[model samples]
Target chain A: MTSQGVWTPEVVADLLLTAESSRTPVGSVTGRWPDFDLAAAYRTQDVGMKRRTARGERVVGVKLGLTSPAKQRQMQVDTPSVAWLTDAMELPPATVVPRSRLIHPRAEPEIVFVLGEELAGPGVTAARAMHAVSAVLGGIEIIDSRYSGFRFTLPDVIADNNSSSRYVTGSVQVNPDGFDLALEGCLLEVDGQVVDSATGAAVLGNPAHALAFAANQLAERGHALQPGWVVLTGGLTEAVPLAPGSHIAAHFSHLGSVVIKAD
Target chain B: MPTGLAGQHDSRTAVLNAEAAERLLAAYAGGEPAEPVIERHPAADVSDAYAIQRAQVVRWIAAGDQVAGYKVGLTSRAMQLQSNVDQPDYGHLMRSMFAPEHVPIPATMFIQPRVEPEVAFVLSRPLRGPGVTIADAVCAIDCLLPALEIIDSRIRDWRITIVDTIADNASSGAVVLGGRPVSPRAIDLRLAGCVLYRNGEIAATGVGGAVLGSPLNSLTWLANTLGPLGVTLEAGHVVLTGSMTRATPVAPGDRVSASFAGLGSVSVQFAPEQQEAAR
Candidate 1:
C-alpha cells in the first residue's frame, strides 16, 4: 500500500502493467488518487502504451467501451470511453485461447471499421464517417479486467485500457457502401448453443455513429483515425464468460462469422 | 476613344471589352504573370477584379478541378496596413489546393511562393450573407483547424496592388489543414495563439484576434459578402479566415510548421525542383 497522493501516471502505469503480466488482479486505484480526472487517466493509458511499445508491441488502433446504453448502465457510467489496442492483442482465427495469459477472460461481439482515409472530428457525422471506412468486419474481443472482481470506476477502467486483452477478426470483409449497417445482426454462440444476439444498432443506435463518436473523442485529445487503422465499435451484448475447452463463435448478417476455441 | 470617355461606351462594346479582359487574364494565368491589370486599366475596381476571378474559376473548373470553398485575405489590420488595402478580399479554393500535411510540395509548380498561418472553419451547415451574424456563423461551423496557406503571386516579383491580387485569385495557392478538429465553442477564438516555425526555428507568433478582430468575424464577413452574389458557404466547405502572421518565404528543402494553442499544429515541406524534361 502506497500513500494516496504518491501515485503519478508513471507509477500507476507500472502497477497496472505488473498486474497484467502476472495475471493477478489488483485493488482499484480510484480511491488511492484524489480527483483522478479523465486527463490523468488518459495520461496513465499513454504511459502504459509507451511501456507496451518498449516491449515490442505496436499499436494497431483503438476500441470504444460502454457505448451501448445497457453497457453504460451496467458500468454505471453515462458516457463511453476509449482505449488503445496493440498488434499483440490479435489472435489467429480458430486458435485455442491462451488461458494461461489472461485472468478470467470474457468475450463480446463487435463490429470493426477499417478506415480508408484519415478522419478528424469535432463535427463528424454518421454519413461522413462512412466515407472514411474501407471495410466492415465481424470481430470478437476477449476482455480481461486487471482489477479484482472485474469491478472498477470509469477512470480505473480507462487506466486499464478498457480491460482489453485479445481480439480475433472475421475473415470476410464487406464494403460499407450502401450496406444497411443498422440492420446488420450478429448471433453469439458458445459451445454450439446460441446465447445472445444483437444488431449493429445496439451500439449507440448505429455502429457508424460509434465511429463518429470515436473520431470526435480522439479530436479532443489532438488525435485522429488514420488510414488502415482498425476501429472497434463497442460490444453489442453482455460479455459471456469464457471457460476452457469452450468454442465461441459470432455470426454476422453480412460479414462472415468468426470462431475461437478456448483451451 | 479617349480613356476618360470609355465609361460611356454602349452595352455591346462593354460586353466585348469584358470578354477581352477575361481572355487576357486567362492567358496570364496559364502562362506567367505580367503587368498588373489595374496598371493598364485604371477603372478596374474590386468588383471588376472579382469578375475576372470568376472567369479564372471557370477555367479551373474546365480543367477538372472542383471548387472546395473560399478564403478571405487582407482581413487583419496589420495585413491591410502592410498591403495598403482598406478592405478585405476573397478568393476561391479548388480541391487541388488542399495538400496533405508532412507531404513535400513541388516548388516548380509555384512562382515566388510564401506561407502564412491561418485558422480554418469547416462548415456543417449552409450559411448565406446579408443578415448573417457571428452567432449564425458559429452555429453553422462544424470545427476549427490549424492551417498553413501557401500564397504564390503570379504577378512578377509580387509587385501588385489590391486590385492586382484580387484579380489573381487573391494570390491563393495551397492549404494544409491540421489533423485535429476542435469545436468552435471549445475555445475563445480571440485568445487562441499560434507559433510558426520555419526550418525548425520560430519565425513568427500571432493570436487569433489578429484576423479582423476574430476568426469568427472574418467568417461572418465572408458569409455576408457572398450573400448578394447568390453564393452560400456550403456545408463541408473549409473556409480559411486570413492569416495571423505575415507571409514567410520558403526555399526548396525548407520545412514550415505552425502550432496553434488549442487546435494542434500543421506542417509542410518544399521539395527541390525536378529536372526539366527534355522536349
Candidate 2:
C-alpha cells in the first residue's frame, strides 16, 4: 500500500526480514501480492540479500532449490532456482544451534561443491560446471521457512531465499572428476532409525547438473559462482524436522558421515 | 524457565530441556522408559515441560506425521490431587496415535500401557480465544465420539510429577475412537455412565461428571488454554476430553472395552506376548 497500493520489492523484503529476525511465522508473500511473478521474486530476493550485506553479512555461497523433479511438480514449477547464502547462516564445527532463536527447522542432506575458479554462464553445461569445482563436500541444510506451515508458492519461496536458515558441511572433500555422483547414495537417520534414503541423482539426476543449473540461473540475475564459494545442490530426500534432543545423521557413499545433535 | 547457560539448580536450563527431550525420545525409540525427567531437572516447571513436549511435536511433524488433535489430562479433582496438581494439562494428539479398533495392539507399542475411557469432542467449528466458554464449546462441538485412550509413560514406573507427565505428552501412547457419533446437544454428557470391561468382566465404572464437572467444561478449558499459544481448536479436529475413570494397567493378551450409556462403545485388544517384542 505504500506505493500504488502494490507491494514493492523493498516493502516485501522489509516484511520478510522482520519475520526472519523476529522468528515469527507469517503467511506467504504471494498471498499479499497475487500478481507477483518469478522475475519480481528474484528482485525481492536480491533486495533482501542487499539488506543482509548492509548488516555486515557477506555472501558465502549459492544454493539451489526445487532441484528434485518431485519437488518441482509439487511446487508447480518446471525448473530449479538459486539463492544466496551468507556467512551468518553457517553452523560451524562443534557449535550448538541456538534453538530459541529459530522457528521450527528441518534438516535436508545436500551435495556441496567448492569452487576452484570463478564461472559465469547462461549456457553452462554439466561438464563445464564440473570444471570449476575444486572439491565436493557433504552438507546438511537446516531450512526454517518464515511462511506458516512451510506453505509457499514458487515466487513466495524464492523471495524468502527458499527457506534457507543454517547449514553445516562435512570434512571429506573429493575431486569430482572420477566420482560416480549419479550413483552417490545417502542415508538419513534419526534416533538410530533409517528414516529416508536417496541418491545424488535425486537432485536433477547428478548434482553437477544442479550446479550447472545454478550457474545459468545466476547468470540471468547478474551473478556468478566465485572461487572458494561453495554450492549446495538441492535436497536428496525430504527434510526431516529438527527438535531439541533429536539426533540426526547423514551417511554418504563417498563423502564422510555427519552427525548433529539438536541443542 | 531458562536459567541462562550457567549451571543453576534454581531453574530448568535450555540445554537441560533439550537433553531431557533427547532422553524421552531415546526411551521412545529404545522401548525402555527412563527415570523421571523431573529428578534430573528438579526446577523444571509446567512451562518447561510444555517446551519439551513441543520439541517432540516438531520432530514428529517433520517425520511426515500430522497432529490430529489435542487431549486434556488430569481433569478429575481426585486424580489431580493424586498427582499433586490443581490444574489439568494438555498434549498434542498425532494422527499416528490412533490405533485400529478390533485389531490387537502390539506388545511393543508401549512400555507398560494403561487404559482409560473418555468422551471425545469433535469440533464442527473452530474454537479459539482467551474467553472461550462452555457455551462456546457447545456450539463448536460437532459430535461426541466414544474413545479409549491407552496411556503410557516414558518415565519409569510412572513415578511422574505434573511436569514429568506434561513433558511426556501427558503420558499419551495411543487412542482408539469407535462407535456412533452423538450430537453435542443430543446427550447430557455429565450423567453419561461408563462401564469398562477387561477380560469380559467389569473392571471400572464412572460417570462423565468426573471430568471437570462435565465433558463440555473440559473442552472449554482446552480451548481457553490453547488460545494464548496461538493455536486454535480447528474445525474437524478431534479433542479427547479428560478420562472419565481411573487408568487401569493392561498387559499383552488383554481385551478391554468401555460402553457409555446412550452414547457408544470403544475397545482394544493387546496382542499376545511374543519373543520378537523384546526388541
Candidate 3:
C-alpha cells in the first residue's frame, strides 16, 4: 500500500484499473488521499480512461449518476455527476450478464440520448441541448462498485467512474420531436415481478435537462459531446441489486423497453 | 304560452348552430363588432366555445392564413380576476398575427384593441402534451423574446364572458416580437422583469413569475392541454405566454413599447385610421 496522501493520479488510476481487471474489491481511497475532491477524482478517472484507450477501448459516450432528486438526496449530494462509457462496456440486449466478472452488481433504468450533432457548452439549456439529439431510447445500466460493501463518498465514486460496468440499450429508437419526455413512464421488473417504476421526469424533472447538465459538466473538462455518442441520462428509480439467474426488464412508455439476464 | 316557449327553444338552437358561429367569425374578420355569443346562446359550454373557435380557425386556414402557433390567456391571477374567470383560456395565432417591430399598425384592422406586454417562446422541436413539465418545455424552446400582444374584442361594447371570449378565439388580434433573441439558459426567467411604456411613459411593470409562477409553466400547461386534442406545438412555432399585467387599451396614434430586462424592447404605433387607405 502507498503512504497516505502520497498517491499520485497515476497511482490511483492504476489501483482502480487493477481492481476492475482482477475482479477484486479495494479499500476506500478517500481517507488516505489528502484533499481528494471531485476535480482530483476526475483527473484519476481521465488517467484510467486514457489507459483504456491505449488498450484498444474506444469511448462511446457518458453516463450520468444521481440526476434524480431522490437519488441525490439518498446519496447526500446536491448535484448530478458523470462517468465514462466505452465500446467495451456494451452488453447486447437480453444477453446474460457476466456475473463472475462483477462484484455486487446492480441495475438501473435510464433514458438514452443519441446525439445528432456536436454539443459543447459552458452554458447549455434544456432546449438548446435537445437540438443535437437524433433519437431517444430506453436503457439499463449495470453498475458494479469495486469498493467493498458498495461504500464510498462522492469523490470515491467519481474515481471509480460512478460504478459503471456495462449497459444494454433497447432496440426501439424514437424521434424525440414532440414526445413528452417528462411524462414518459417506465416500469422495471425482476423475475417477472415489478420492482420499480417511474417517469422520465424523475431524471432531473426532464431527461433533456439531465442531458443539458451532462453537457455543461463535460464543458468543464474542455470536452464536447460528439455526434453518434449515446448519453444515458441516469437512473429514474432506485437501483436494485442483481442476483445470479435473475432477469430484468425495463419498459419505457413511447420509447419501448430493454431486458437483461444475469448469470 | 306553450307556442311562445317552443319558439324560444327554436331560436336558441339556431343561435348555437354552425351558421351563427360563421356569421360571428365573419363579423370578426371584417373588423366589425357584433353581439356577444353568450347573450345569444346563454347555455353554451366551454366545449361549444372551443367548437366555435375551431370553426373560425378552419375558415381562416381555408382563406390562406397559416397557423403560426397558439397562445395562453388569462394566466395571471390579476387577469383571471379582472376577467371574472377562474380558469385560463387559449387561442390560435395566425401568420397575419405577427407584426414587424417598430412598425405602425393599422388602427382600422381592429374594433377595440388593447396592448399587453408578454414573454414569447420560439420552439426548436415539436412538443405534445398530456404530461409536459417545466423542464420539458424549457428543453423544447429555442429562445425567448419580449413581445406585445394586441388583443381585440370582436364583441360589441367589450361586454364579454368566458364563452364569448373563447368563441372569439380568446380575443387574439396581433403580436409584435422584440428584435433580441436570448437563450433561455442565460437568465433566471422567473425573475425576469419588464416595463411597459405608453407614449414613452411608464404604464406598468411586472415580472415573469406573474404568469402562473413562470412562463415555462404556462407553456407546460399548453402542451398538456393541447396534446389530447390532436394538436402539436411544432418546431419554429412561436408561443405567446399570457400577459404579465392588466392590458392597456390602445387608440389611434398611440405608441406603446415594452422593454424587458434582458430580452430588449418591442414597440408598435397604432396608425391613424386615415392612413389605412394609403397602405
Interface RMSD of each: 24.2, 25.0, 17.0
By summed lDDT, which 10 consecutive residues of candidate 1 chain B come out lowest? B270-279
Question: Under CAPRI classification, how is model 1 graded?
Answer: incorrect
Question: Candidate 2, which CAPRI tier?
Answer: incorrect
Better model by lDDT: candidate 2 vs candidate 3: 2
Regarding TM-score, does 1 or 2 come out ahead? 2
Q: Return the TM-score for each candidate structure.
A: 0.49, 0.50, 0.49
Candidate 3 has a TM-score of 0.49
Candidate 3 or 1, higher TM-score: 3
Q: What are the candidates' C-alpha RMSDs?
A: 21.0, 23.3, 16.6
Candidate 3 residues B67-99, lDDT tens each?
Answer: 988889988765677778877889999998899
Show where candidate 2 strays beyond 4 Å: A1-263, B1-12, B275-279
Residue B275 of model 2 has an lDDT of 38
* Each prediction's DockQ against the real complex: 0.01, 0.00, 0.01
Model 2 chain B worst lDDT window (10 residues): B3-12
Error of 3 at A241 (Å): 0.8
Tell me the lDDT of candidate 1.
0.82
Error of 1 at A200 (Å): 49
State the lDDT at A7 in candidate 1: 72
How does each model score on lDDT? 0.82, 0.85, 0.84
Chain B TM-score, one value per candidate, order as shown: 0.90, 0.94, 0.92
